[model samples]
Target chain A: TIVQTLERHFSLQDVLVGKSVLITAGPTQEAIDPVRYISNHSTGKMGFALARVFALAGADVTLVCGPTYLITPEPTIRRVNVRSAQEMYEATAAAFPKAHITILNAAVADYTPAHPATEKIKKKEAEFAIELTKTVDIAATLGTLKRPDQLMMGFALETNNEHEHALGKLHRKNLDWIVLNSLRDAGAGFGHDTNKITVMDRQETVAEFGLKTKDEVAADLLSIIVQKL
Target chain B: TIVQTLERHFSLQDVLVGKSVLITAGPTQEAIDPVRYISNHSTGKMGFALARVFALAGADVTLVCGPTYLITPEPTIRRVNVRSAQEMYEATAAAFPKAHITILNAAVADYTPAHPATEKIKKKEAEFAIELTKTVDIAATLGTLKRPDQLMMGFALETNNEHEHALGKLHRKNLDWIVLNSLRDAGAGFGHDTNKITVMDRQETVAEFGLKTKDEVAADLLSIIVQKL
Candidate 1:
């Protein structure tokens, strides 16, 4: 018991010493009006867990997240808070160049209101339509700018055709590794504290993980990254 | 010090004893698809505060609320959680007939997606439009069904034309009291724990309250209702 306690107390492995890591988390909100917005259910638990593990491993981490109540996992982590997909893209892009490893995990909105009204839109029309425009693709954009030394990871949350879609995104976005989580899986994705992930690499190698706490999943994910390094 | 401690320990006034109270709180989500939704910034602090105060006053409270992480203030208070505005309307309506006092505090959506996709909508189209249909007006419908002895209260959160908009809503919904909070006012409306409010009745009497914590505001509002009863 004493040995385990001692190990726990001084267990900083420093495996990623001198490494600069960038991570994005939570769900981006696209304002429809001054009061209303379009968003998803991401609570940033997975991404926050990833930041914590990476920090524990002695990496200098930068976490760019959307609006969420989740506290910064490590005081050392430089936290950048953004609201919209555009804001997230700008923040992530700015942090990407100096980072050794980049993780794109935020559930960024695909579309945003073409024109957010200055005032609250009154409820008058029987049928109202909100015109939407595609948000900038943060991962794909960063993928192009990635240097040979930089390792990039992306996440795909799919409701159907999970594997095919994830593989498509992996190649399309030019990621070194892709983590796939399905909404069909219970206790996985969005607001859940537990996750089941399948990590796929360019070699078509897939490593599947069982349902586990987000912290455990993060540690497993970090181990894979360390091996590649 | 001893008297103050005794008062704090035995503070239940039981002013609303044997009263049947119905309250709604939080922001109702309107589904755009399986994963995405449209919602307002309501955190339900004020409504939950009202529910807590009313429960402490010995009323039988049924709190029909929208999606929020806030816990039910009292174990004896019946809490019915609803997601969409339509669901909220049905739940509120069902509980209205038995209620002596009904408080429409939830920020119910005015519109909902006309046709929410069954699966996650893939990001393909550069430009998209979400067709929305007007949601049923819960307060107005309940107002028509209200008996002479019943009292109904409603909330108005306005960004512009604050007083006129709130007054219009109060008359249109046939509410006994309308509590107005403006977005322009700092520390008021939506997510804030503190609020500044203007209460108006059919007599055109306006009573403005200084900014205070939601719990204190709830007590003030209830005191007025007690006098009216």
Candidate 2:
């Protein structure tokens, strides 16, 4: 009985001893001018939390992050820093082939200034508009290029027809799963400390959670991913 | 032609004047003991930003928040602070009747210790566990209690089946609209400096956004709310 109990209580390390995972985090800056650019409020907390969890699970982790004030969670995890969405895309693509699981958590810009001003434009004009073009769709790109054995997850944040839109992206991006959220919901999005979420897979399985800290959520998510693998 | 050009300009204040709005922010702490508790990662940045936006738009705002490390955004906005999920629920119920628009953003802990330990238990750990019970369902409670004229918005974050799960919440919570996101999506969530989101409504309408600052997203989301109202 003593031996059986001990065997049943194996550490998380015993479960994830040799897995490799990649995660992208924070918001990619889209340069509008030398002194000015566009980005978002992704503080890198969620991604950093994921890195910690994955590392704890004994997976080798590569954390690709955008500009943020957060410190790296672990010394052993590999860190790659980049700025613009284009750079992030290139880095992610380069890292994809080597990953067993990829979490695309970065908030990449969908558009960039078609012609970024070399210098800051003066306030001479009463009104002006900058020409914009679509940035590379990072998740969709990864979806198309993903290995069959590799698990790819995407995120969707919608305001209207929230589910339909998220589903559309899930299908379009060829994701194994997609995490969805909304700005209309209160404590769930950017800059918050706690979150509530649902996990959805290609098989249409859903696992919903109530509010929890990002750390706990990451642990829960990693467990789900490990189970899927 | 000259008269038409002059007529195209409109003051920003004209857009938001005389609106009544209720906003909830932060994370609710469920006390296990006087000194210990359960909570989540809700920094309240997004909700505070929304308050600021609505205030800027000329709305009379009431900001209800759980315990957080954030300052009140405006003098005109009324602020209420609460600790437990029960307190948050009471505060929200009190404020809901008087507001025209409501945004539920607090990350209320789903479970509380069934019977909190009177003092911190001494460490003699072979194994430890705490019995948990469901806390008040803030979103669903409000949804059931909402006035017909009140425009309610909900948020969802999922790891998988992003769209389907968000839609389910939209219906479950009786939200007029929902914001959807996934944990796998980068730069869109907790503690980040930036965000990307989608907005969905009862009509199944969807508005997708690229990465933008939290402040910018707040502005955009408020604009939509105003239009819907």
Candidate 3:
């Protein structure tokens, strides 16, 4: 522990000194009404970890995050806070052109309330249904706009057919690499400080890592990205 | 501020000594699936404040709270952590018979997903509807079970017709007193340290209070309960 702490403080990897990085973090809260909302379990630990790692490596990082209580990880990092998926897409897209590398890490909701009530909806009916409409696909949209010199990556969290789902997403989003997180792994997904991840490329080359703290995972991800860069 | 702190430390009002108090606080999250949920904007500050006030005044407090990041207000106060409205109801009802006073302060969901998926529901259809069923009325259910010696109070948060809605709930739930919070008030209600409340009794005795810190509001509510006791 002491050695790790010492290493973290003493290590200065400035490989990305002139590079600009874009990252997204946290879960988007889709409003159902003034009082109620639809949200997910993402706490933004992984995304925040990535931002800290990138910032420490001397990159100019801009973090576009959804609703989360986590403070900005680094003082040098530019933080943009948004509440819904649409806002996240706009913010990320705006910063995409200037970024050398972009990481779509936020767990953006796939659907939002079709009609969010202005006031709190009173409980009158015995049975009620909430109509939801699909949200903009941030990664897919940005993927098409990515320049040849720019690198883009994203994360895939799956409960079933982990490998197949991740591969499909990597190709569909046109990401250079995709990080996979399986919920079946204990102490590995949302809310956990530790994570076990698998990195996959278009070539279907897969590199799996053991469970480690989010900081360590971030470092591993950075190491891979830096090599490619 | 120093004078108030000194008073809080020096004041030893043990009027509620040996009496058990039941209090519920925070917003219940009804599961949509493993990763998503439906929730409201209750931070549990008011409920935690009430727990602190009651505990300091020597009441044996059992605080049944929904998912919140807030820590236990007092070491002596028993805390029962719950996630959904159903869980809150079960936990509260189990402790009700022994409680001399009960305060229903939580923003319990009136509806819950009829079928929460075992796995994360994939985003497939362009439009989706989440079917919801009515949740058990914790206040009204417990109201019927209240003994002659016991006192029951509840909170009403309204967006429109505040007085009329609160009165209707107070009578319908058979509450001894109802505290109303109208969303129209700035810097008041959910997520704020300050609150503006109107306390009303069964006989229609209304006591309106200016915007005050949640702790001060808790003290005011306790004073009224102590008088009735």
Candidate 4:
């Protein structure tokens, strides 16, 4: 009782003083040329929201991000910007070993131009198809290295089979918790300020949440992580 | 010579004093919920560039846009922001008849949720699919109402059959000009500061331009339109 009261009286800093978190955010660009690339609509809002929440709670955060207009939400949160899936993987891998919790939130490209042209391709023919090759799966790759003490999380954004896909990814990636975003949620996905999410665990337990601003959602999400930690 | 000198001396406003231009920019969202949507990676950069160029050149420009984070480029240029393909179509339809030149630069959704749920959909089932229906064709809809002297331009961004698709769109949509953005072009597609394009006319005249900043490309495009005018 004394320890609990002392901890509460000290500050939020006392609660999370030694905890470290790593987060991956935004959309990775798959370059087709000097002027062309493939990417998603992620604006890095949710991840940035999470970073802000974690930083305010006195946890050290490292944010590895793709191309976005956003700046670091707090001075304490370290930021690393990357352009492609490969670059994101490298940065995340480098940061993973030092963190107690790792959240995979980036919409990294699944494929990239097989042969990006050196020069601008001209309109010689009426039709064309740029060959695409699969990219490295960042989550699965990092999952292999996760220790029992480290908490690993993954996110799934799906148009169909949302729960099945999320559960499958959770097991396959060895994630402790998986956040699922459904396109069926009208105001919940990409570029929006609000989100409704379902958090699934490795044991297949699921907790559904209501539509709320990403800031509120982030706090809710961090509380879940804090409980398990 | 004296008339030309007088027009030049008066101001840029004197040159395009009577010209009215309307542009559509950004990616149209197909809502599935109050908090979620289906959208592409259009940032409204190209359309905004065109609007900026026209406004600076002294033309009265109206910009009907979809959801994007970009701010209005110029104060004098009219701006309208909308979400969903239906909203975009209605706004564009209302503004179509008012301008002398209309440039359809928006990446409007081809399909939308056939039945959007009002409440946040709970993931009870393991697998599910959202049925989608075709959205209104913004370019073809306005093309039908084009006047003899009015110039209508369409933009086609394609991965396959670039020229053939663009040519078909030019005649089918009754566009005076069609700008083609091929994924094959190294630096000529979405979310990039630069572009390389091929402009095709209804008469089958094709003009190819090298990679350049969107601002420079916009100037080149406006010059091409000026020549025809």
Report how closely model 4 matches the true complex, as a DockQ value. 0.09
> What's the lDDT for residue A177 in model 2?
85
Model 4, clash count?
16
List model 4 lDDT by residue over A1-229, tens digit each.
2223223433445456688999999988766554445566788999998888788788899999998999899999999999989999999999999899999999887666677775444334333455567778889888899999999888888776789988999998889999999878889978899999999998899999999888877877777887787
Candidate 2 chain B weakest lDDT stretch, 10 residues: B1-10
Can you give the lDDT of residue A89 in candidate 4?
A: 90
The TM-score values for the models, in the order shown, are 0.95, 0.50, 0.96, 0.67
Q: Model 3 Cα displacement at A60 (Å)? A: 1.0
Q: Per-residue lDDT for B1-229 in model 3, tens only? A: 4226324544555778999999999999999998899998899999999999888889999999998889998899999999999999999999999999999999999999999998888878999999999999999999899899999999999999999999999999899999999889998999999999999999989999999889888888888898787
lDDT, candidate 1, at A114: 99
Error of 3 at B101 (Å): 1.1
Best by TM-score: 3
Q: How do these models rank on lDDT, best leading? A: 3, 1, 4, 2
iRMSD per prediction, in order:
0.6, 24.4, 0.7, 10.3
B1-229 in candidate 1: lDDT tens per residue?
2223223434556768899999999999999888899999998889998898888788999999998989998898999999999999999999999999999999999999999998999999999999999999999999889898899999998988889999998999899999998887788888898999999998879999999878877877777787788
| Per-residue error (Å), model 1, residue B115 | 0.3
- Sort the predicted structures by TM-score, highest score first: 3, 1, 4, 2
Between candidates 2 and 3, name the one with more favorable DockQ.
3
TM-score of chain A of 3: 0.95
* Docking outcome class, model 3: high
The sequence of per-residue lDDT tens digits that candidate 2 reaches over residues B1-229 is 2122222332355466776888888777665443335455567887888788778768889998986768897888999999778898899889888788988866665655677665433324333444557777778888888878889887665556667777877888889988875455677766665777878888878888888776777777776786776
